[model samples]
Target: MKNQTKMWLLIIISIFSSLIIFIAASFIMGDFGNKGYDIGDLKTISNEVLTTIDQQEKGISSILDAAHAEHPAVHFEWIQADGTAIYNTAGTPQNYDFQQLADHFLSIPYNLWTEGETISLVYKTHLQQQPYYLLMKLPSTAMQPGQVYFFLRTTKVLLTLLLPLIIAFMVPYLLAIWFFSRMNRRIHKLNHALTQVNLQKDIIVLQDTSKDEIGQLTQHYNSMVERIQSQVIEIEQFDNKRKQLLSNLSHDLRTPLTMILGYAETIRNGLYKDDRELQSSAKIILQRSRYMDKLLDQLLDITRQNTHALTLQLAPHNISEMLRKILADYLLFLDGQDYIVDVHIEDTDIMIHIDVALMERAIRNIIDNALRYGKEGHYLGIILKEQQNDVWITIKDKGPGIASAEQERIFERFYRVHQGRQGDGLGIGLSIVQEIVDLHQASIHVTSVPYEETLFQIRLPKKEDELN
Candidate 1:
């Protein structure tokens, strides 16, 4: 059910349960409740007093006096059948102001006015030998017979019956209200937290102190914030990288373009009289053009990688054979150069799912990086290992290893490790490699120590069923 629906359902159930409990407890306790001056009991007492007066032939005053002593809150008056006053306890009039009594009687609704100031009865049987009317006058307190009458008569029984019914109805109702009130406060807190979120600043995570639906909502909100924060950071980094790439492109192109322009102008303006000088100028111009073309190609590669337009041709293939061939190609390219290639493979037929061309390009970048930067060490090692449900390719070099602080930025486009290094290529090979690896759902990590050794490890997932 929806949370709001469930909340209301529970509240309704609590109220219904409280009502049921109140009714059930009241019925169960009724027998034990106070029987305070029941109308029937009062009538029986009055008949007994009348009998006593008839048998003794004593005046009605004596019997009324005794009844009055027994219940001080009540008084008695007798009136003859002919409307003559026989006896009155007050010794004056009936002591109840007729106008005031009539007004009080009229003020109350007829259905609600059960017992009032006077309870009168007429005696016409032979036991009295004459017709008479007995009028009972009750105190102001007993004039209204309600719960208070029972309390004034018997406290214990009345309390026992009332306490449980009152508690049953009120306690659950109050608790349900309290629970919903707490939920309301938490919802408001969540709303405030959401309203206050600012993208320009770090994300704020709301506190989820409860183990309820509200807490779950807060947790999901926090997770969404974390994902957005990560995307924002990635976008900012890409923006910074783009700015740096343009700056480097401008600086790198300036020298070569200047050389090409100056030499061409010299040849065009006939500034070089000697044939040899003219040939030299043309060769320099040609060389600068080639360098510029190569720089443009690298820039294109970076653009393609950053824009995520590289399509992958995924297939299952032997990774070990692929590595060996890649190494062989590198060896041929760097033939006779001061370099060494060492290879290790645990299995020659270990198959993996990959985009062959992209994976090859990724591995080629690592090897090219080793050959270029590790020229001083003159040694490179490639290790391929198959583990349970996974495979790893590690390339190690013993050149002037990267500094600890620069390792994290090594994969950034156009990021040069040594700013003063002699180079004609843009620093985007590793970045492209990282992009391809990410496309394959793979992970790469690098460990390097200055002047010691650098290791780059790439991990890829493998399934035994696919291999079989």
Candidate 2:
């Protein structure tokens, strides 16, 4: 669920980033386009104004001829066309080049431009909108003929360009907002799922079962939840077994000790004084006392592992040298027995952090278990291998392999896998081996295949941190 939320967030942010780039670029391009059109309109209107004025030449001639015929001696003339002007409402001629003024005026509808020498304010309502300027050339006989003609207008050009620019701004802006909202909705849904996950509560099953990438991700998350549920169930089962084993321990050993204590009190303090009676009572007392001592010792070693009395002093030491010394110590005790001990080890530098005495006791118990439970003529084998960062030790034998159902409980205290072969000592040897390995955080595994081999393997990490 957390993963899904992160994916949706990334997608949403990417879409928003693209939308911002698209809108910015579109705005710039639209403005540039409008600017180009405005420049063209100015130039085209300049040419049209010139045409309007040139068509007036014949009219100007008719008016000038009538004035000259009426007053024959009046002197008047028009010559070299320099420029023009148009007057505002304030009766001032618009200043600048004649062509520029003509372009500015010609853009207005129903407006006319003509070359003239006089400045005057003219109102023409025939234009679609009242223009900023309207210019006309005076007759050749008019006053101030020294001035050329010019005109100016701005209203029509602005209205022509305004509508399209507004459309350009709105269309893509609306679409970008629409796309961003869509991606935001997807991300919000995914975030809700992750909120449930962070609280360590049950997940809400997403109902959007569409066949897209989101659907695939939802399916994977559901599978992870199922696997986690199964592991939790396994842990509960182990906890229940641990409780059952503790209950069994109290029942099994207390019953035998009660009888042994009762009988010992009867013989002590002159209760059995005859020679034959004394001898038999002494033997019974000695045997029962030894049995009780062994049971108490086994329980005490594991239960108070941190007590100063039981805790072994740990030090750094070479593992190969220690194992060789342990092997020599075991050899003299098994001199007469036909059982063979095969040791396979590498001649490499493998050092470890451990209590030498406790380690020796742990390995001896494993060897004893093999010898006591193995089938006819099967020898015990110990193989040790080391890599740069770890060591693996394997103990194998052709024992009557433990049943599949008993493999897990076989490591519990007093769990006897083979009932017929359980007479030598309490069934806590493998338990001790497991406890020691657990104390060091090393790993242990057991596997038994029918009629082939039974193996106990231990894996220990390489000692890397030096004692400081």
Candidate 3:
């Protein structure tokens, strides 16, 4: 059930429970006070009072006088069977109708009855074994001869005792009701806020100021929304890139295919004048064909990487040795470039698990990029640092460094910082490098200052046993 419903239900039960307890206590105390006088109890008190009065030497008259002196509010008359008043209190009327009072008592359910707006108590007793009736007039029916009755016209006494009882039971009950109501209202407000929130516009927030469990829930929900928003933005960006990629791929492929088709058609039509011209046409066709093949291969590699279908042959190998071997091929290529090479390797040997072939490709791709764009700076440096359980390989070059904004995007498929620069290969070299690095559970990032220097850092984790 809803919290509000449960809270109201609990409050109702508490009030009813308290009321039941109060009524039950009243009944119990009433019985304990002996106010609900049974016939046996009334007979006992009447017998004692009558015996004392009969033993007096002056008879009922002196006894009545003495009782009147002691209790001025008490009034009674001792009536004989013949309706003659043997003894009457001073306040008794001279023509008091005893027959009417006796008849009135017989008609009522209880011995106590009201007479003309006055209330009194009646008891049947015997003086000297002769049957008589003791008729007592009282200020209030509540002030009986031997017991106090709480349920009569005892307003002052009942109010005096009931005021404190009401406060003792009602104060806490009211406070509890207020507390639950306040909580229910706050929760309802929170629920309304949650329902009205629009994630497409902005994150949902609770206006509640208290640092309670609900507040914590709001914080966690906000965090989850933020993560979802970021992922949505990233997916949208990737979608845009994919659209552009298809357009670029078609353009790049069509250029080379058109050239190859034109030259082959010319050769087939024998449009060339001599063998030399024919050979030139054939060589151009072969070069374009090779370029297309290379582009297609890069495309395949990227597709496989994205689909998690790229396989790796994982084995422990010395990372320092791997770097040296990959650089050997680049050293051969840089022979006529007149570039200065600064190579740094820590003396310690570090063994890390990696896919050797893929890692070499990633390294070669980065160095090739450096040599291609950084030729003007004429300085290439390789640094390898072996730490406790990790390896750091940094390649630095003095080149027209990449802009900060383009650093991250350069790793996208077919993305090139300087598209105008002459190049023989597809623009997926860096993208492939990123794919391979990620496959080996490694991280790679680049930082550069324009026209100054660019540093590409790659961190690889080593196995725990190897570190030990």
Candidate 4:
């Protein structure tokens, strides 16, 4: 639920609960206080007092003694018709004008008379046929009906006025503590998780089951951590690959550089026997220099691709024609290599969007790999065809094919297959091929069987409008 609605609900519940407790306590206390001092008990005592007066054969002295013994908390006074005090249960007898007092008591309203802290009830009884007034005074503090009624009324009024103020002040104060404490705990957990991430350089996911705002914050935090974790893993892998690339480049450059230097030195010092020998040394030096130049170029190309510095210039072109030209160039280069070039180009006008230069590079890398490694098999096959919405190009060679385990790693930078023909080229060609294909939103697959066929297939999505 929304926080505002939840707060309102809490306030309402607290108020009602407080009111219920107040009312229930008032009733319990009232009932407890009125246990033996209720109006009915008072009436019974008054009746007993009159009965003892009537049955007093010993006189007024005996009646007073009996009344005091029966009800110790009550004070009784006996007066004549003229308000002259005849006897008193309290120490000294006072000649109080009881008749005037009785007249004043009768004149006052019943509700107004019951507001006092004491209850004064005047009784008219005949003592030996003479009218006598008995004034019994009961302290309301002893749980008389007047005091209980007054207490209930007054307490109700004060509580009614104060309850809202009490709830207004206490509810927010109490709720502030409770709500903030709960919020603080959640925030503390998030802070702790962040601290752990900072300390360990690792991702920490929090478990938040609530649907509140705090829970949403937790979800966002977890998502951010996941992204950071993924980026961290990618960075570590990139660093390892970079180190590998540097190592491979140094090793590869050293060989060609060493060969070029030795050949150049031999020619420079006049170590050649004749013009033909000198020419051969120069040629060897030139070839090694070209190889080193090509290796450097490849390294730069792969680096550019990896760092997103290379962007594809996509245009619609007939891949079939592109493949034909590429194959023609390769066939010219493989003139006397004693290799069979099996080419099958499907005559379709299907056009696909691609970066011509990058796509050519990717296809050439696969075919070049096949030729370099599959020289012993003396076979190269290239096929281009349209299937459904995609154009598929398959290059197959009958060389010692890659193992299943090595096939997956073959596209990784500088990851060379050590078991087979051991081509002279560094292992970044296929890595560049994969990157180029991915940039075109295309897919590549490789499958090989030793001495049978090693196949590299490229699938490029055809332009939908052109296909239609």
Candidate 5:
């Protein structure tokens, strides 16, 4: 249930429970108040007073005194018909006329007057045939019949006004204690988890399965922790890759630089035997310089890709013709290299949007990787075909292919399949290939088996209108 609804329900239950307790307490108090005496005892006392008077065994004063002794909570008075007090337990003289008081008592039903703080019952009787008045005054607390009824009526009026007021104040107070206690517990858990996270620098998750507001807060907190952990891991991996890049660059550049320095020194010192040797040394120097320059260019390209600074000039081009041209260029370079170049290009009129320069660079990098690593197999296969709305370019080579474990990391900067192998070129070639393909919004995947066919496939979306 919703939090608001649950709060309201708690209030309602608290009020109901409070009412039940109040009513029960009121009943107990009422019953306790009425415990001492009742109308039956009063009637019995009055009858005994009459019998004593009729027997003439004792005077009216003596009789009243005896009754007073029997029920001390009651006040007894004997008055003549003329309002003269003949016997009185209280010494105070009557301020009002006895006849009026008697008349008031007689006017009430059952000749019993119950009001205010006291209950007065008047009895008319004859002593020696002479009319006298016997007044029995019982305090309201004595639990006389009329007094009980009066107290209950007054209590009803008081409770009617007071009970709702009490319930109204009590319910929210109780609800506040309950709500705060509940919230404090959940907040404490959250705080404790946060403390652990801060101290340990590790993920700390709270176990809260409730679907309340606090539960949702907990879920969001857990999600945030997960994101933080993932970012931390990503940062560590990036740092490692950066260190690897610097190490590889230092080694690769040093070798070419050292060669160029040595060759220049040899020519400068006139250590060469003839013009042919001098020309060979100059040429070697030039080749090494070009290789170092190419490595530096690759590094710049990767940096631009990482910073999202590389822009693509997109235009639709025939993928079949593009693949054939790339293949012809590679074949010219391959010339007499003992490698089988199997080419299959399905002539398709459809074109795909691409950055021609970046795409060719990507394709050339893949073919170069194959030629370098797959030299032992001496076999290279290139295929271009259209399948549905996508153009697939598959470049397969029979070489000691990548391991399943290393395939995922092959595209990472400076990650080489054959580590510590000199002249393998910086391993950023395939990484740059991946970045270019991603810019074109295409996908690339590689599948390989040891010394078997290693296929690199690039899938590019066919032109939208052509697909339609």
Candidate 6:
């Protein structure tokens, strides 16, 4: 996968990991929460029932006392142990049969009726219709979970156990996510900008004003970018210097090779062979030798320009006037050439700051290449055009356009595409032009449509743009 895609995957995984930890912790702690204290409705109802039981026991005693004191004639009743009537206040024979009463009394448990202890019941038969109060022995058995009285409340305990754990885990997990979510988005924006930076495209810098770890990271990232830009500038300068040295050396070597070839070809063809012809050949040989010396000198000058501090002999001069004068000097050598030349500058006298001699050599090398290679009647022209704020001095040729794959390499030294021809070139002209353009802070771009049009478009800052 690409570096960009891998970075996004890491960021997404971080968020999910935080969420997963929260869920697992919540599940483990949920079992221990205490909710039973809040479900107290059953205790309230049991207390009210106990109060009713106490009132019923007291009312039973009041009725028993009334039967013994005043209802003696109405077949008054009395309870006794061992199946006997201890007292009958009524004159009539026993109203409740003793055998039937003792059996009925033994059936009702004593715990259901009284709190502590109970005496025998005293009630007349007419007054005892409201209740059959039991006079019996109490059993001492206790109640527990399995018996009918026990119903453990599980619902109340469960609710009390789970709520706070849900809250305890949820708040921190959400807080962590909310905190990181904003930082994550900013990092994503910065990642996009950094990827675009490698493509030589413009980037929008990330803005994070928060005082946090993410903010510090952004600041460091920006500082790293600044350092990288400085390093790139230094590396490019060294590269250009290296290419320049090779180009000059190759260009210098070409003259002697050209002479050597010309002499060998002339001797083979058996051209006129007098002492003057011999002298002419010798003269050409000597001239090429000296040309090598001048090439070395030019190479030294380029090295000086790059290594030492630059001292521009800045002056305001018209670009068109200078080009015309340089073209006039080249008229003798180019008089018989078949190439077409056109000049269409917007201003004849727009003064700008430049080193005039250096600028002329850069422009002249371009025209010289055109004359040498405008073979088989191909046309070459120079046009100067302007748009908005900049002026372009474009030199175009309809000769074989430089191939799409070879355009970038053209500015490198000693890199000859049209190989094995020494008089033709050593590939220094374009390299020199590129260096001068860099020094001037102007831009150069070469674009070509194969089998159609090839252009070397040089954009120069206008008079107003040049500040010395």
Which stretches in model 3 have alpha-carbon errors above 4 Å?
1-6, 25-168, 193-199, 207-212, 273-279, 309-314, 318-353, 375-396, 404-452, 457-468
Model 5 C-alpha lDDT versus the unseen true structure: 0.80
For residues 1-468, write the lDDT of model 2, one tens digit per residue. Answer: 564465557666766786698889977865654222222333343344334435553443344344435434222132222333332222344454666545645433222233332222222212233222333332223222122222437777776676786677567656766665765566577667756763245556555665667667667666765666566666666566456545545555566566567667767667876878877877876776776676677667645543534454567778888777777876776677876778988787568887777777788888777777774535678888886777788877786777789888888765667544323455667878877776666788889875468888888776745212
TM-score of model 4 (CA atoms): 0.63
Off by over 4 Å in 5: 1-175, 195-200, 347-350, 465-468
Once superposed on the true structure, which residue ranges of model 4 sit more than 4 Å away at CA?
Answer: 1-176, 347-350, 419-426, 464-468
Which TM-score value belongs to model 6?
0.43
The TM-scores of all predictions, comma-separated, are: 0.57, 0.44, 0.61, 0.63, 0.65, 0.43
- What would the per-residue lDDT of candidate 4 be over residues 1-468, giving only the tens digit for each residue? 855566667777877897799889978986865443656576777777778778863487668767777787677888788878878887666776646575545533343334445556777888788898777766655553444333345666888776887877687668776886688779889988888875246677999988999899999999989988888887788888778667777777887788888988888888889999988888888888888888878878876866887677888888888888899899898999898899988766668888888899899999989988887889999998888888899999999889898989999876778623222666788988988888878899999998889999998888644422
Model 6: per-residue lDDT, tens digit, 276-321?
Answer: 9877876776777666765665566556545753445556678778
Worst 10 residues of 2 by lDDT: 117-126
Q: State residue 344's C-alpha deviation in candidate 3, in Å.
A: 7.3
Which 10 consecutive residues of model 1 have the lowest summed lDDT? Answer: 104-113
Error in Å for residue 119 of model 1 = 20
- Candidate 5 lDDT over residue span 12-56, tens digit each: 787778779988997787676546566767788888888888888
Model 4 pairs whose backbones collide:
none
In angstroms, the error of model 4 at 177 is 3.5
Tens-place lDDT digits, model 3, residues 145-204: 244345646678788888998899889978988987877777776677567655466655
TM-score: the better of candidates 1 and 2: 1
Ordered list by lDDT, greatest first: 5, 4, 1, 3, 2, 6
lDDT of each: 0.75, 0.59, 0.73, 0.78, 0.80, 0.58
**TM-score of model 1 vs. true structure:** 0.57
Worst 10 residues of 5 by lDDT: 144-153
